[model samples]
Target: MKILIVDDEVDILTLFKDVLESVGHEVDIAIDGESGLKKFRNKKYDVIVMDYRMHGKNGIDVAEEMLKMDRNTKIIFASADSSIKEKALEMGAVGFLLKPFDIDQIIKEVEKIEKN
Candidate 1:
């Protein structure tokens, strides 16, 4: 699967990229929403893993925009704030991962989406 991961934290980006790539997925990383949106426009990804909080556009903002571009877009919102899960789901996110999540959890979510 081709996956795009948008997050401000370099560590998180690196970790996810490495893990996903190791599992045979093509992974792309963006440090902020603007860059992420730009990449999303330029390529077709099977899934997008986005951080809910960032300096520029937040995850919800990015997800909303991406969905407008492609209503079927699958977004997995990741954040330390569990409170936003409901809102993320309302906006059509396929999955929500609380920050400090296990890497296996992310893989499981992606696999679940892939199965569907």
Candidate 2:
């Protein structure tokens, strides 16, 4: 699977990249929404794991823009804020992972989307 992960925190980006790659999935990292969108425009990903809150554009903004470009793109919104899950889904996110989620959880979510 190919995945794009967008997060402002370096640690989170590193951890997710390591975990997802270890499972034999191709992974790309973007530190902010602008960079994420740039990368998204350049390549195709099976799934996008994005942080809900970021510096320039939030996860919702990025997801919305991506959906505008391709409504079939699958997005998984990951955040510490549980309150945004509903909003994220309403904006077309396929999944939501609360921050501090484990590798298993992430993998499960990705696999679920893959199967669908």
Candidate 3:
């Protein structure tokens, strides 16, 4: 699947990119919400994995913005902040993954989405 990963942390982006790539998924990345939204508008992705807290727009903001363009767009919210899960759900995220998660969990979540 073509995946878009948006996060403020460079290491997180690289880690996810490596893991997803190792599993044979095409991936794109955005360092912040503004850039993420820009890239999002310019391309199409099967799934979007985003961080909840970011420098500019934040994940919830990005998700809400994306929903305006495509309500059915599959989204996964990844964050260190626990409270964002409820907000993510309200914003139409399909799944939520907290930071420091096992790679298998990430893969499982993506697989679950693919199955649906």
TM-score of each: 0.98, 0.97, 0.96
- Candidate 2 lDDT by residue in tens digits, 1-116: 99999999999999999998998899999999999999999999999999988999998999999999999999999899999999999989999999887778998998898788
lDDT of each: 0.95, 0.94, 0.90
Question: lDDT for model 3, on a 0 to 1 scale?
Answer: 0.90
Q: Can you tell me which runs of candidate 1 are displaced by over 4 Å?
A: none
For candidate 1, write residues 46-67 as lDDT tens digits.
9999998998899999999999
Candidate 3 local lDDT, 2-116, one digit each (tens): 8999999999999999998899889999999999999989998899998988997888989999989988899998898988899898779999998878878777878888888
Q: Locate the minimum summed-lDDT window of 10 residues in model 1.
A: 94-103
lDDT order of candidates, top first: 1, 2, 3
Q: Please give the distance, in angstroms, between residue 17's alpha carbon in candidate 2 and its true position after superposition.
A: 0.5
The TM-score of candidate 2 is 0.97
Model 3 TM-score, 2 decimals: 0.96
Question: Would you give me the overall lDDT of model 1?
Answer: 0.95
Candidate 3: clashing pairs of residues: none
Report the C-alpha displacement of residue 107, candidate 2, in angstroms: 0.6
